[model samples]
Target: MSLFPEDIASAARAIIADYAGKAWMIATAESCTGGLIAGALTDVPGSSAVVDRGFVTYTNEAKMDLIGVQPEVLAQYGAVSRQTALQMAAGALRRSRAHVSVAVTGIAGPGGGSDEKPVGLVHLAARCRDGRLLHREMRYGDLGRDGIRLATVKTALEMLAELG
Candidate 1:
């Protein structure tokens, strides 16, 4: 089924409501999951009060241009590494008026499998209100592009809850 993870939708609603009550805005910089995290948040009726915007930076150049990710970071660690994820999140928080931001980048594919960075290699990071950043990496196995993205979105939602 090409559908969203239901657990994510439930958690996202709580996160949205929490941030809305705090009057804090959030943003997303997405790659492997496109804008699914944003979509999940927007699924909640009052999400507009907490979500400011989302940036789907699916390419390295887009990540650099839209989120201010330094070229040096990409050159040193590539786009799917923790360093890049941190840069992406920080850049999103810096550029957007949102109080916080999350970033995701990875090779979510059935063809991009490799020993180092396999098909389900996802890296996630978040920049919180106090200017702190948290990052996590996961290999969701070869669940194909959609599956990997869905799993990533679910994990991202958990991270969002922690951020909330």
Candidate 2:
């Protein structure tokens, strides 16, 4: 069986096939889902033709440094906000050779949740080189850490496919 769930694997396969047909490459910027989105994409054979790289920016500093997320954006909106997700997607596309990019940031945990920003609240964004952008806010309740991360991965993959 594939290491990724069937939905994720199938989504990854579709992305590879579609992007490869168009000679497009994909990049991922991940936080709460870690590199799982990229891992799922790369799991498909011949993904190298469509996937350029993935950045696991689990920290604010990493997000700023690796993907050029503005320090001001992180400070004003925190790492898990839509502003940050958009910047992450744009930055990934700017830094990589990829023609499309997806970004995710969120709190996935049994702890670290506040009334305003609860656990399982995720922000995802996708950008295409032609300036197409998409964003989604997912409130998955308290699905624990693993569940939240997996859900984020699934959503991120779908965003990539949508952008592709």
Best by lDDT: 2
> How many residue pairs clash in all the candidates, one count each?
0, 0
Model 2 segments beyond 4 Å from truth? Answer: none
- Per-candidate TM equals 0.94, 0.98
lDDT against the true structure, each candidate? 0.88, 0.93
Q: Which sections of candidate 1 miss by over 4 Å?
A: 1-3
lDDT of candidate 2 over 86-156, digit per residue (tens): 99999999999999999999999899889999999999999998989999999999998999999999998
Write down the RMSD of candidate 2 (Cα, Å).
Answer: 0.7
Q: What is residue 107's positional error in candidate 2, in angstroms?
A: 0.5
lDDT of 1 by residue, 85-136 (tens): 9988988888888988989999988786678898899999988979667789
